[model samples]
Target: MSQTKLTPPGPKGNFLLGNLQEFQSNPLKFLLNLRKEYGDFVQFRLGPFQKFYFINDPELIKEVLVTKQKSFIKSEDIQTLKTVVGEGLLTSEKEFHRRQRKLIQPSFKRSNILSYGEDMINTTLNYIFKWKNGEERLISEDMLNITLGIISKTMFNMEFKEGADVIGEPMEAVMKLGIKRMRKIVKLPLWVPTKQNRKLKKAIHALDDVLNEIIKKRRACNEKHEDLLGVLMDAKDETDDTHMSDKQLKDELMTIFLAGHETTANALTWTLYLLATHPEVDTKLFDELNNVVGSSLPKPEHFSRLLYTQNIVWEALRLYPPAYVIGREVDEDVVIGDYSLKKGDTVMISQYVMHRDETYFKDPTKFVPERFENDFMKTLPTYAFFPFGGGPRVCIGNHFALMEIVLVLACIVQQYQVTLPDDHHDVKPQPLITLRPKHGISLLIKDR
Candidate 1:
């Protein structure tokens, strides 16, 4: 191991803003350029106060996230998320994160997945019934509605019809404000009663009231159900003999909703967009669906038979991972590879960039589900396609999300062929709390 300190080269930007302006303008494109210009390990500044190192090399990425993970916590960037989600799983650190992850892991096990599958199928079918042949639909919005319904039911064991009316619009408003606050260079104080701040407060209150009422009723009922909330309610961390408090439960519920609902919806939206743009992909997917399910709703038992459908979902994730960037804050002075990472420094890895590297994937930008024929992905290094992240904090719902996507895609594609609307919408990824379509994708829903 080398003992000397060696900094990676990076572009010089404005004296005051450093690289903040470029990153704020277009984070994905900015990061891509940094990789192209600065090689594997690139050092840059966010502002006079913040410094960062970008790790593009897969080997070193493993070192930061897995081999020596204890040396880092989630980047300070996520602290902004605390405003919306509170100190839930995504924002917590160290032993707390570990303990919470353990308590929550049971709900996502393969056994429990079978239970969630029914909810997924029912929710998707309900939403799909609204589409008529040759009708142009806002696919992004529809996906968000469908995912929000599924997650709410699976997590709380309740229908969205009851809470969605009160929670839907406000929750969406808060999310928009939350993303803006999370990325602002000069973030405004929450106490300042500006119009946007007031709007955020209203949004937060609207969601909080609905969630609090639900928690209250659940507590009073004192009965167990097969929902994630029920599991969380009864789970006592034996190490401390303590159960989740009401506040903690709400926080975790919010975190789960954001992680489970929004990310999955964006993934589905991207998958639909990809299928619409590539007619050959559409043909192959329908052929697979026709052979396997044959005009019937996709069931849990049909899981393994829908191999090609699963590949299509994986390809969509590889190209447009909802959380494009995963960031970690250095907790102590540590050596990774040949470089010394000082305490308080931030290191980031872009799943989006690594997934599209020409070195790892042939025709990296194209959507080629066939590339995954016969479990071909196993040949690649782990970091090359880590859409759900890695190590101890990897997304707990990854398996559940994948299952839901494959089943939903198989169900929808088995009956419909989606075509793009003629409005000429400039569809692109908007890097926010999740990578969403900047302008909603419009698609014509037609019988296959």
Candidate 2:
């Protein structure tokens, strides 16, 4: 192998900032434009030192995430995420990640996920039942609240009677701060006592307080439990039969606390927004729900039968995946396609960009649930439609998320007709740690 450097073509930025200003302005558009102007394997600099390779080709993405994964690791952004989530599954590396994932995998098993369906439906009904007919509501907030309630009940077997903001608020602050840290060229240590650092510390402390209390009470109970938390508590490494320590448990719980609800909430929020804007798709979804559920609440058994509903969810995720982009850093010099990426170079694969690529999806910008009606997925490359990502580090809760999205969408759309307010124009994606509505989606709710 030659120790030769072959960099892909990209924008020639100013000597100081590189592409930082453009990226900071709008990351989604910047990446999309990168693909449009520079083709699949594009390289760009953030500041003077940070080199990023944007991979749009499915095969190259497959190489980075699956085949040559050992040559790479989670990107610098995930490192910043460690401040909040600790060394949980999302942020852990190599063997520890494998071990943690293996231990946590069982909790999302089909049987365990099926058991969570009732809680999903009931939780959605509980929150939506409060919406007065003919009243306007921020559907994004509603989705967040309902999904938070569902996660609490299903993961902890505890009902949040007050509201979801208990966890939602702190989590929001932590995520915003985390993104802020990611964007900064010079990141101060968490103990630096700057205003941002202080806010992050305060938010993290609030989360730690909540999570520590949950673990404390659960451990005090001293009985076998069946929820996700219980499963994690009881999970043992088969090699050594070692159980996770309290800190380890708290980290995993925090990961789930954020991943479990926030992503699903955003997915549902976008799904409803899509449904409201696309009345034809909305009508088809309602028809499917009526035929399959028919005034009865959605159950786990109905999951498989609701094809169109599932398509609608899939389509929404394709258009507005909460985890909009995936990033990895090269561990060694590696050749992906024609480019030889050196160690420490960052690779970005954006679902937001790839999902809208004209190559995979026809009329890529349109909302077409029917596009998935046939075996459309089979026609595309494995990495082409990766909303949950692919390879070893793919989201653990993919099944739980899809099922929750379908059941919740079914329960809500079946009972209520969701429409945008007369003055409402559009909701832009915020592109935080998770893709959220920049302006919370406002919808007019009415009885079916």
Candidate 3:
């Protein structure tokens, strides 16, 4: 057997703080540099106590996420998210997680996903029509607001067309607070009365107030609705009468929004940015859309026919995966590659790193939708391009999101021509909870 006890080679940081300061400086650059210097697998310490291992190799990533997945749970980092979204699928552990997943899984099935198609396209086009030609729009905020509305309409039966800020603002505030709190060196207690803490508390209260009202109204209603909430509320297991309580339903709603909202928005934002920068690729996508989905408007039935549009989404996901890293913690002694990991160790597998590695993708940095045209996915390892992660723990919203993204892109492209700023330098990748544009992306559009 390989010496699983051997520690992977890595740089030593300060004895007291370990790598905490270096990590706090610029997480993306630091991690990328570490990979360049130490090769695929590298070990580092967060402080005197906490140890972390970064796995960049795809086959090794599959081993942890798929074959030996039972030995791990979500990383300790997501505990912060649990405070907001509660013990829904995103943070639940062991058998409870599995059970909740089974219950929530049906809402995103093919039939249900197809049912959502009308809402997805109608909502996107309704929002897009508000844009004026020659208007310079902040692409990031627009995408965030629109995707927030999409999730709300699709899941909760809410319409915030004119004022998505009702849901958008508080959620954005709370999410930013969560990300900020996650990076604290010595976290301030909630009762400390700091301005930041006070703001965070306010944000949480505001979000809770909205969620509480939605739950109350839904419970009071007798009429059935064709939305995710309706399915969740009516869901039952024949083996047992167990179903989500109102509070549990609220938790899962928050989890769905938290998981689905900004990530999909960021993804849409990046895809537009990429298309804007690459005119040739943009023309190809528009041509494909014109041929397959022109004037007639896009629906779920068109998903199969829009092959090139779907490929563009795949390539964009490969380039700028919204969830940059998938993190998990060891729950027991586990062997991964040549290293033995004890309980309490954190493991991170980066989609950003692997997707850009020259070893796997030729001309990895270039935008190439053609790469996805072939049976490349079959030839690649399961984890080589895992934007939604892998294994039993993979993101449940994968199919829904893919279909929604393709529909939105196809609908928008069929009628409008997107023009990007000549200088792409300002819109840098900001790795927060999602990979966002640091300065909001500036864009212009005209009806084609």
Candidate 4:
């Protein structure tokens, strides 16, 4: 006789909406509270039919993302994202994703990424140099703009400073609308003329127009450029000898455009906020920068020697991960740990929740950059500190993002002292498609 496995205990809600209202009101708090009350593997409902399992245990998360990853696929939110990004690497699946990854892998090679360091530093310097000493600015927007400029110049061999508004405004609208679509139980077709639907379409169109123009110009150019766009355009499959179509190029470019800058921007914003609030950490960081680079611009060779600088970024990521949650849906009936999950069931793993778990770090709620010193990462489970995610599907731009964050921070902090305004209030993390600062981070800047 076979033994029976009962569903894990979870918060019981009314028969109809079952946990949907609670989740939508505040997702981060709901998940944190759920873990505190229901333990590691808790099963809950979203709508009338959708089943969700929240996994806080590191081993179970590993199973879902790595060991038995084939049994699951991206969750519904990612499927929702395809409306904006098309079938790019972030939303693609199976063999197609593997193929695209292979074709695009070389552009992120160690040597290739090192070459982009100069552009990253120069872009940071140029943007920050314009800031008048003792001026107050929304550091969040500055981080976003500088990162957008860096990604554009390094990847596409083009400057985005003049067109920043063209991309920035519409991109914000798209991300806001994307989150709304993900949470709604009844999604209307894009063809429908509802106000939200029309707005989404308009935002997406604005983005499409900008990207399509770039793709068109790149295709028309005859020079064999060495940048990421050039590499993508010229790459040929080993077996088929076929290059990416314009549509495919646009999809990948859109994916990179959003992922390359937005997440890193948030990371840096949080980092600056953390540094502003914690003066001791900020002082140590400045000390490291002064000793390592010594009144010169940050270069690729200086990256490895800046251990404290890297730890500060790592700590920021641990606290406020840009992609706070990773969701997956079961592709087929599978068993994770002792739980029996049926096909169509969704699994949620939150880096925000996990990074703060007391089991992994001492004084989990506090900001302590020194926690990452002395090989602290090696002691934790792989999934416990997964800011870039894990498995074959881990972020392809992890290396690029890390290098950019460290270099940009080095450049700016060495030149300016970033401190919160005297009237600065606490900054709250806004849980969207990517985690961002609510309202925005306002800071006082002065020449160091």
Candidate 5:
């Protein structure tokens, strides 16, 4: 085993659980404060089983996630997600992940995603019909429904009215259970006969049923379409193999469905909420959008045209990053900066903290979209603003998510003005799978 100093310049951790308690309470805030107190490197123990070296240094983070990626593996916490996502790209082994990523890559081509633009526009308009004039809509739920619909329509050509709530109910249950487990309020495994375990099983079954039915219908059809499922059905591997098995297809489809909607929906929701509260930003964005797309729906061609609007999206992602934290484990003893971590030691790159690092960003707390206009943004260090993560395992549906967010934002802005019902309510972020508003942001939507 390699040995190096374990010393870090920070408050010593608690003897029992180290800093796990504070971490569990409000992880995003805790890490932000911890980084403030500890500087770039902090060491803590996760229970008595493992040690974690939280590295806030950008260079060191790049080394682990990019340059020295082969020396590390997805952390144990990520491994726990295998039950939910299966051995899909997100939680699979290095070789398996590589193979799956290669296989699934063609499904997310720009052309394929562009073909789904009409579906996205139609879905957004469908949701707009549900909004009552001057009704207080929980923007969180509204955004969830919108993204869920978009994912269903674009990915599988399913109708939002017919499909979203059905798939969403189980997903919500699974997410609630998952968050509870992550918080350690419940400690039962999947095989256990407890209530949470049972609910997890049921949720899994419900989602499986929905995906299986969709898959079956697609398979039975004679002709092919340009949606995500069609691309997956046509994807070819290295050995000239074509087609994913029913089981593989189901797992990947469900993974994309949940991940596709949940993360992007939370991001768009936060973006709108932020814009609603900040009138100057809102008006600036409105002017930009009006100039770019006029009174029409957004298209792939308009993405580059709305440069300022895109910057606002980037800034919002930095402030309330959907993929809050990414973790990895040292496969062998290694030195990161001045700290040494043993094999099996886990490390977290908290984007919540990293994005807010005052050293990297001026006035880190402010939402200034213009910062992205700097030439250095294209050359910014890795993990500095990795809302979608970094390196090989970066989110595959990134372009799709971006396209959806821009289109959805454009659609909503064209029809309604959003404002928080109560201006003084605390708008804290709660980090689960994605960083979401702790309490739902209730907004009154006035027709434009």
Candidate 6:
């Protein structure tokens, strides 16, 4: 394989250790500023070893995400996630990934996700019941509990409140550790007795215990529930394999609970915050809701009818994509647009940057849900608006995630009115394994 060297970067820190230190201090700011300086494809080094070519170009992004997908693989950073998430669809490789996706795809079908609508509405309503008129609550944490409950109930058919406290704690702990691990890739091996490593080990074991217990209880039952767990348990691979092992089921369960739950929660939380800050956009969303599903809990089909509401979710994701950056490593030299990408090169495409690029979106800084409804989205390239990613490896839960977000948003809109606290500052984003709100959104809710 020939090496295709990229254009010289603006500057470098050292021959071996490049911009790793600067990139670590502030990833979002660093990427944004780098875009300004380097156009769309900027070259930089990660730590002492890896070379990166940041491609914010939508066409080039599409080339990697769709056209030449097989030439690249999930970057090492995503492999680190397997430490916490295990070898589910997100972490598995090649044929294993294909098999897992085939076995699990049916579980996220429209009918199954729609069946979970009642669970979403009920879980959200339960949370709303706890909100007092004058209280200021951390909206992110609140949504976290609601979505976690919804995912727990809908996926495993477990009584969410029964396992919420136990499962939720370890999940959060592991997420924090995953973040710390990403920031600094220490030289210590996994077995070392470091605080983060110990916590990671404990957190993984705790989650595995919870999942195993759930699987055993389900297996012991006479009747089967038609949720994600049952679907995956019953699903067969293309080879007519019915033997989905307990460990396989456990990993898939962990992946769904982690990916399907918190991501939707973050999206909905950000949507609410965006609504509170932009009253006019809120009014338009309300009008759409009133005209579409007034006073009634939103059904799955109503999701398509709530066009403006869907737009709000899209725009929110555009602004604060839960998965901020996607990374892939090239296995061979390739030409993407005008640039030559070398093998062993790590590349990233930012939904954060592309969504904000003035070239693609008009007034990209403004909150405009209607922008998505136009012919623009129809004509847009594959990578232009990949909130759930694109191509064969696209998030299998795309439909499920969208449905969960829309239903939860509608449920909240119907039952209560919410706003940012009086003294609440504008929210900033922290780009991590997920794009999280820097200062959690604080909200005051009143029953509608």
Q: State TM-scores per candidate.
A: 0.95, 0.96, 0.95, 0.95, 0.94, 0.94
Off by over 4 Å in 2: 1-5, 162-173
- Give me the displacement of residue 187 in model 6, in angstroms: 5.0
The sequence of per-residue lDDT tens digits that candidate 5 reaches over residues 63-129 is: 8888878879988766777677677777787887887788998778777677777788789988886
Clashing residue pairs found in predicted model 5: none
Compared with the true structure, all predictions reach lDDT values of 0.86, 0.88, 0.85, 0.89, 0.80, 0.80
289-391 per-residue lDDT for model 4 (tens digits): 8899998778988988999999999999999999999999999988888888999999999999999999898899999999998899999999999999999
**Model 6 Cα lDDT, one tens digit per residue, 138-231:** 8998888888888878876667676487677777877777767866666355689898788888887887888898889989997977877888
> Which parts of model 1 are misplaced by more than 4 Å?
188-195
What lDDT is obtained when candidate 4 is compared to the true structure? 0.89
Estimate the TM-score for candidate 4. 0.95
> How big is the positional error of residue 231 in model 5, measured in Å on the Cα after superposition?
0.8
Name the TM-score of candidate 5. 0.94
Clash-forming residue pairs, model 2: none
RMSD for all candidates, in order, please: 1.7, 1.8, 1.9, 1.9, 2.2, 2.2
Pairs of residues clashing in candidate 6: none
lDDT of 3 by residue, 231-344 (tens): 999887656888888878888888998999888988998999899888898899888887887768887789878888888898999988999988899999899988899999
**Per-residue accuracy of model 1 over 37-145 as CA lDDT, tens digit each:** 9988888999886789999988999999899999998887697788788878999889878988888888788787877888888888887977899988889988888
Model 4 alpha-carbon drift over 4 Å, by segment: 1-4, 163-173
